[model samples]
Structure formats: C-alpha cells, structure tokens
Target: MSSHPILHANKTSPFGDLTPDEFYQKHQVLHTHSFISTNNKIKLYTQTWRPIAQSQAHPPCGVVAMIHGYASESGWVFETTAVAIAKLGFLVCAIDLPGHGRSEGPRGHIPSVTPVIDNCIQFFDEVRASNRHLPAFLYGESLGGAIAMFICLRQTGKWHGLVMNGAMCGVSRNFKPVWPLEKFLPAAAMLAPNWRVVVSGNLVDRSYKEKWKRELVRRCPRTKRVFEHPPASTALELLRVCEEVGRRCREVDLPLLVLHGEDDVVCDVESAELVYELAASTDKTLKVVPGMGHQLIGEGKEILEEGFEVIFSWLKGKIKK
Candidate 1:
C-alpha cells in the first residue's frame, strides 16, 4: 500500500477566500498520514495524535475514532481534541470522511447514510484487526456525532465507549426544509446542487467565535464558494439515522458522554439532553459548558483541556469498572 499525505489549496468558499497555506501552517503541529482503505475504492486520510509514550512496539491505552462535521475535514475539526485525548494515553485517529479532505469520493456528495456508516464500521474493523491491545471508542463532532450514534446503534457490540460533542439529532429550523425537499425534490436540487442559501446564526464567545469563524473561512473555502448549495443525498440520510438514533438511544448500552455548549448556535442543547436522558447505559453523563460554542475544543485552550480531562477521567473510570 502506498502512503503519502496530500495537501490541497482551498478552492471552495469559506476557506478559499483566505490565505490557505497560512491557515494550514497556523495549525500544522499535528501529524498527518494516509492509508488506502480495504474498500480499495476509497482513499482515507487520517491525522493522528498518538501519546508521546506510544510506540509501534507498545500498544495504546485505547483507540479513538474521531469523526468531523459537515463540509469539514478531520484536520479542521479536532486538532486540539486529538492532542488532548492523545495526552490521556490514547491513540487518536481523526478521519477525513469521504468527499472531504483527501478521502476519495465525489467532492461533496453523500448518496445515503448507510455507506458512511459502513465506512466507519470498516475503519473500526481495520483498527481491531491491526492492534491487539487497543480498545476502540467513537468520538464525533457535529454531524460526525450523528454518524457515530448511528454506528453505535447498528453495531452494538463493537465499541468500548462513545463521546459526542455538539451532536445534531435534528437540524435547526433553517436547515429543516432541506430534509423533506431532499426526499421529494431530489432531481431539481441535484441538478442545481450549487444553489446558494444564506445561513445566519449568533455567536456565543465573542473572541473565540470571531476567530474560529475567520479560521473556518480560511481553511474551508469550498463550503461557501459553491453556488448551488444542495447537500449530498447521503446528508439527508443522516436525518433518518438521527431519527432512528434518537428513538433507539436506549438500545446503546455502552458508556457514553454527551457534551454540548450551553449557547451553541449550530446544534440545540436539547439534543444533548435527549441523548443523555435516553441512553440505556447507566454510566452516561451530560456536561453543559457555559459560554462556549459548537467547537468546544477550539473555543479556548483552557476549556478544551478541561473538557478532555473530564472525558479521560470518565474513560478511565469506565475501564476500571
């Protein structure tokens, strides 16, 4: 298998309008590498933050499968979280979901939810077969969190635990119309998928929110550049998964931690509450970080560190029990 990390200039909206190389350089501390998936058709890119104590000869305390949000790559989503989790003695694998980052697929098309979930399952299988000592956990942000929840529901016995930050059980009202239209008006939108739509929201953390928004604009230019703005059909499938996951949350018997910002503009805090209340696991916890936004880890170094500490402590306690 050939392996080399690939870097592309930002050509899409949000990031495209900024200085792409500078944006990447600012957060270039993490290690990046690529592996060809067993499903040879898809190329997967992963950014890893392994514990300093870790070596090929010594297995990790656990393996964390990190998934990113919509229109964003793994690198863009969890740089700080990955490092923090790694410091807690785990191997963090932040994957670029298909159609984002270096992963191969139609640029921004997701035909349905099953394929994405299948890819995640395949990823876990690969990890389990490759590393004997490492237990696997799911860590997802935003839309990625929704995907993780679906995987946990469908493949119940596979994971050790699950951690979700700003998970979307349902899209906001502004984005809701797209859900139904996706099911009925598929042809019209797909034909003009680049159609533009305005998304407006308020910021919770004035400083971090502004900086993060600027960073997003710099790193993910494609998000805003597309004129025809219909998300992939697979994106709609995400809602179906979310509906099922919300109803079947009780089916997930593994330990779970659902974290959300109290003032999150992207995803409602109620979603986190629902997951916390519905999960069948007796060891679940819901933490609401006051004055933070959707990107908990990137909101601030102190907030990010404290959040990871909570997660690590919880994971440690779970392992002991």
Candidate 2:
C-alpha cells in the first residue's frame, strides 16, 4: 500500500515542511479544487485527486466519493486519505458542505439535513458520471458516515460499496448534551435555530488520540480559529438523523466496511455494532479497533497503518478491471 499520507503530516502542516504543490508532487498525484453553486445559491467547494498517469490515457481503477465530518472540510488533513487512495490508482473526490470550509452558509449551523444531503448527491453524482464503467465507492467519517448511509439508502444500488470510519451511527451518550439541556433542544431549536448553545464534549481531546494530531486538527488552516460547535438546530437535527439512520439502516444493502475505534467517545461504538447487525448488506464487515479514538488516522503510527491497510485492501478487492 502507498504510505499513509498522515505519516508525512506534522503539527504545523498536513504537508509537513513542503508547500502544497510540492506535497502533491511528492505523492505523484494531481489535485484540483473548484466551487459549485447550489440551487439555493450556496457555493459548495469541491476537490478531486487522481494519479498523474490517470490524467493522460490511463483510466483510474475506480472512483471514491468522500464526505468529511461536521466542522471538517474536504482539504487539509482530510485530503490525506484522498491522496493515499489516489496514489494506489483510484480517483478520489471530496466536497465541503455548506456552512463549512469555503462554502457559503453559517458556520456549524445545519438547520436541516435535506439540503446537506442534496448538495452531496449533486456533487458526487457528477464525479461518478465521469466513467460509468468503473466501480465506485462511498467513504465518510464521523457525521459524514451517517450522510453516506442516507445517500446509499436513497440511491440503493448506485454505489458498489461504502466505508465508514468512526461513523456517528449514534452520538455517544457521553458526548451529547446533559439531561435538561437535551430535553430543551426542541424549544431551543425552534426559537433560536442559529444559537451556538448546544455544547458539551471537547472534540479535539476526544477525537484524536495523539496530542500532536489533536494540535494539528485544531490548527486546520481551513477552520483556523473558527468556532466548530454546532448550533442548536444542527445539534437537534444530528440526533434526529442518528435515530432515523438506526431505524432505517436495514434498507442499506450495499457492501459495507464499518471501522470504528473501540474507545471512541464522540460517536458510539455500540451503535456501529447495531448498524453492522441490522444492515441488509450481506457483505458487511465490522472492525472495532481497541485503544483507538474517534479519528482512526490519529492513532499511533502502527495502528493507523494497519487500520488504513484494511481499507485499501478492501477497495482493491472490490475494484472492477
């Protein structure tokens, strides 16, 4: 497998000391960014990474549409996985949902899931259209995992497989708002939909196991000092989405690879188990790695490599000529 790109990342930059152009050259992949306007006039940012050779006559082995977690964009640390997959001869694309990254919307305010889902479908469909013959897969992390499941449920057999890492099948009880605060979410959401009031867990400390990695994620050039806490409306919608996913995951019949950290506190591991059990996908596989946190990529070097190795191997086995 191509070395996990995270291996090159430092606390200062995802590219270590290399400039963005040098970083792409180091990995031998071509990367590009663009923006698309949604029907509501929201400008969603999108990125694509492909092996340089594929830019010529050679076609890619397959296509991978990726979705990043809430508060997370498609670039910076998130695109390392894209580069890793691209180096192994597949095309990978990711989109920054509205309210995050360069997209236009209130930061961390997801008033409704419908528009977010629609935006994803709009972007992913275009990338998948490039080479209809090549097998395609959906890859999402954290909240993105839930959205990916919804996409698969809606599109049914449009995708060949799905891979979710640290997926928020359900929010960890330890992470959600404490008692009375949860009870008032409906009223709070209705009255002040944009209020950044739903607060409890510390994602940086809870998500990344390594200290340096936590610092790296916190300093994300895209987010910089932006407040990442979801507003009342988004918080309420996320809870609803989790319940809806658990209630309807049985309809998800595509091949699946569910990877979650055994010790993840931000997203429940048991919910992942529940998903693995109830999913209609006959080819589903569940792996709960011990001693890891919400971000599998931030696990110590050895663990990160092994975890990603499983993903790469799975993708290669499923690819069509």
* Model number with the top TM-score: 2
TM-score of 1: 0.76
lDDT of 2: 0.87
Tens-digit per-residue lDDT, 276-315, candidate 1: 8988898688888887767665455556556656667776
Q: Which stretches of candidate 2 lie over 4 Å from their true place?
A: 55-57, 225-227
lDDT of 2 by residue, 262-308 (tens): 99999999999999999988898898888878898889988898789
After superposition, the stretches of candidate 1 with alpha carbons farther than 4 Å from their true spots are 1-32, 38-40, 55-58, 174-208, 220-235
Clashes of 2: 0
Candidate 2 TM-score, true structure as reference: 0.96
TM-scores of the candidates in the order shown: 0.76, 0.96
lDDT of prediction 1: 0.63
Tell how far residue 195 is off in model 2, in angstroms.
2.2
Candidate 1 has its poorest 10 consecutive residues by lDDT at 1-10
